[model samples]
Target: MSSSIENEYFCDGLTEEIINALAKIKELSVISRASSFYFKNKKTTTKEIIEKLGVATFIGGSVRLSKKKMRITVHMIDTVNDFLFWSETFDRDLEDIFKVQDEISLFIAEKLREYIGHIEIEDKLVEPLNLSINTYREYLKGRYYLMKFDYESTLKSIKIFEEIINEKPNFPNPYLDINQGYAYLGTMGLLPADEAFQIAQPYLKRALELDLSSPRSQLNLSWIECWQNWDLQKAYEHANNALEIQSTDEVYLTISSYLTVEGKLGPAQNYINKALELDPFSAINHHYKGYIYYLQQDYKKAIQFLQKSLTFNSVLPFPPIYIGQSLLLSGKFNEALEYFDGLKGVSLKDLTKLGGKTMSYAFLGDVSKCHIGIRELETYLNTELMGKALTFLVLTNVLLGNYEEAIDYVELAYKNKLPIILLFNTEPILKPIKNHKRFKKIMIQAISDNSNYTPIKRYRHSLLHTEDISKYVKEMEQVMMENKLYLNPNLSLKDLASYIELPTNYVSQLLNQGVNKNFSEYVNTFRLNEFKERVIFDENKNVTIMSIAYDSGFNSKTVFNTFFKKKEGITPNTYLKIKRRN
Candidate 1:
């Protein structure tokens, strides 16, 4: 059953109560709150919801509350044939809200049982809650703030939950919610892990003491065990207990992340798929799906899912960050640079944003800018944000061809037990040094105690490899020379390969092996040579410098200047002035 309520402090909580009540029917497979609430205010057809959620029937409704009265209107729809099976509107006094909820839940359950075949209604399914309306209102407000999913909002929710706990010391819901808020803050790098987990421990324990059957309490305990104590068995036990109670999308995604770090890709993929199925429109689920594909080195699918995530929530910086990383790895350096440049004015100032800029500049051969970002990241080394900052620094160094320093940072991250190091074995950004003895040794140590330890394998072959390197090299040079392909500002490796009737991988290999340069460097070498001949040798005496650059395949003047300075140790104008003086 999916429902929304208006003009009430505890609208979401009331909706969740109805869904949970219906889920108690042992015969019915209920759509979880995460899946149902995903369509709260969105305009969607019943068929679309059914197909996405895999439900045969759905309940939709809203509640309106006045000062002293409440009205709830609900409708049941059979998605198979788009028929309204049953519906009703009920008016009741504010004091009878709990009774109204019970009536609605039982009425729907009985009607559904009659329609689909009779099933016995158990006594345990309708346990009475002994909560006051004021306490419930506060609990709902806490839930509302928690759903915002930001560090500040989470902190606010924790404050609200703490107030509730003070007023009603026996309330288990607020205790569980406070633990979840702390977990979110710690996991997202917004708070120190030690500080967050230390504060959360008592709340978690209290919640379980009050309500031993609460799945959320178990889930929160699992996170603390896995991340803080590193107790895999206990963590698994708690996670399993939570899943047995309810297999919600958040729980599935959490388990997927745990499996990913353990190098259990197959099982992780299953959980991630389940998460997407349960919450298809969730940007976070899509982001994690792309991230899992990325860890598996499936760059094509990684970029596809990451792009889809951006379409859902462009305000999020992580999707674009992953997309840029995927393009850089696929040898589309120019495209990746363009994407990074487009994020110039975004408000996000986190390590992801800085890392994207650093890696893009490093790959594009802008060493000064890359180092600037590195220095900025170094400022966070002594601060509480060291884990996140250092992880990105490692990525930046890898792109800058500073493998030794990258390994040094990896060692530090490992020593600190940062969770980001869990991806060391499968992260493509660290692939250049995957075969390094030190890197392999560190990876072995990182997961040595875990049962699922696997050796990190080096990628022996390029994604685009050909046996006849010299043949492709000659063909590539001829195509560039005869067609003057470098004159096209928008030329890409795919375009060049299509023009020469060669495979993209073959062209990439020729550039990497025969020329000792990537696609971007190979193309820019020609452009720089053209610029030198035209400007330094006075081949274009009457043309402006910008026009000469534009004619020589450089799209942006700033990029042309930066590339020229990086290659020649001087800007284009300075180089020209020196040549003329000579």
Candidate 2:
């Protein structure tokens, strides 16, 4: 009843007489002959068709004519119970096709009406949710794309969902609606962490409010919180809640793998196995199973499962990355390099680069290049532009003997108030710096909000020459002053590179050779020193926190507070008050 029977199926190839007669059926919920026939000869089962059509009973038939006579055969099956309740065969002339279909349809409807009236089937058939038929179709398409798990195809699904919502804004299908945004955020990693969460939260919240009966929204939110914010407690509750409501979802357990990596193996294993049963073809599911073994430090088993994942979707990045990571931990650096070599030029994004570059440098024993890789990762972290990528950098930095740099990133985790230890423990790249005293101390302080780097390749292209270096830096500083921009905010080597019209890597090289400071600490040192001087010497106290923050070129109040606390060990307000008292 939600969709006009005419809109229910594709009857494109059927004769007009047949289409019109089928359309006239008063009782048969005959999906329009055009729409129902769309699946002709396609290998879909009765259950799948019933689910797709949103109908409890489906009536199908075939017609044949021989020796100038026509015969019709029709069967009506109870899809939910998989039983053929009624069937009939009619013999007639080919010209009587329309009459046969109409008569059969009328007869079936009258019989159903009588059966429902007598047995009260109408009382039990809960009316379908208030969803536009078009939106529901789009949602099914979105689910189809999600099942495929390829990046490009998944993105296409998101675009369809966007179009669906645009077409019908008030449609109550919130779970299907907001899932597109979550996919966008997860895929693009465009917004900063807090900003990303803000974008995704409304859809998830609305989904919960609209349908306590649907678990997909809650399940997605739980994973995002776990992976993006490291909020395990909330993740556990949401994930468990979803499984309680719908026990068949595979992703419900995949989120638990993060907890497993933090040494909660039993729950992790339980969820991973359940997810596999629900969707056995998912390469990602297999990768997680392998990841669980790696978490238990069981390298051999990890290798086996990860390899199996490759057979299903050879292009999937994590299984290869994890295999490489386990290889590194097992001291098979050379073998790890072989793995990373295969991953180059694949669309593994920033985080994969961290793992691939780390293993490559470590296996080759190129300590200086390893540090260079770590510096590049530092540039990524201070920007906080990408979470999965930043996670990669945090571990890689520790691996390359740059625990001091790890301090800078952990400062970010603390500012977000995320549990840094949990992440640090599971991330194989940080295996090198796990025990450093300064790193541990900073992790405990819960101070410091690190700024992120913005990628600007246009700026990087201009500074390939030595002469351009001074000009580039001077122009950048001038732009900061011209705009009164905060020097301490999420400025990356690329931003400076973009400012001067040079390449990012070139600017990094110039800074290393000319300025002798890596991208982040170099910028932070300038900001911190300026902050200290302004508090002590700017006596008129006309510099309100917001004014000074802008003058210093900081972007947000949160970033300013975090930077101030980490650099000076006091809140900005308290620091200002103490300075004034003195």
Q: What is the C-alpha RMSD of each candidate to the true structure, in Å?
A: 27.0, 32.3
Q: Largest TM-score belongs to which candidate?
A: 1
Clashing pairs in 1: 464-505
lDDT of 1 by residue, 1-582 (tens): 223343455666667777777765545567766667777668997788888788787888887777777778888876764567567898888677677777788777755653453333443444455677777787788887887666666789999999888888987888889888887666655665556777888998898999888777778887876676565556677777776665567777878877877768888888888777757777778888998988887889999898887666565546777788888888888888778777754543346667677888888898998899899989988776676688779998988889999999999877776666666667878889999999988877665455442212212354444557767777888889899999998776668879878655455556666777766567778998998888865557677888999989987665677668779998777887788898
Off by over 4 Å in 1: 1-9, 24-27, 44-48, 51-54, 96-103, 117-121, 126-130, 310-317, 344-349, 435-582
Q: What is residue 536's positional error in candidate 1, in angstroms?
A: 99
lDDT computed for candidate 1: 0.74
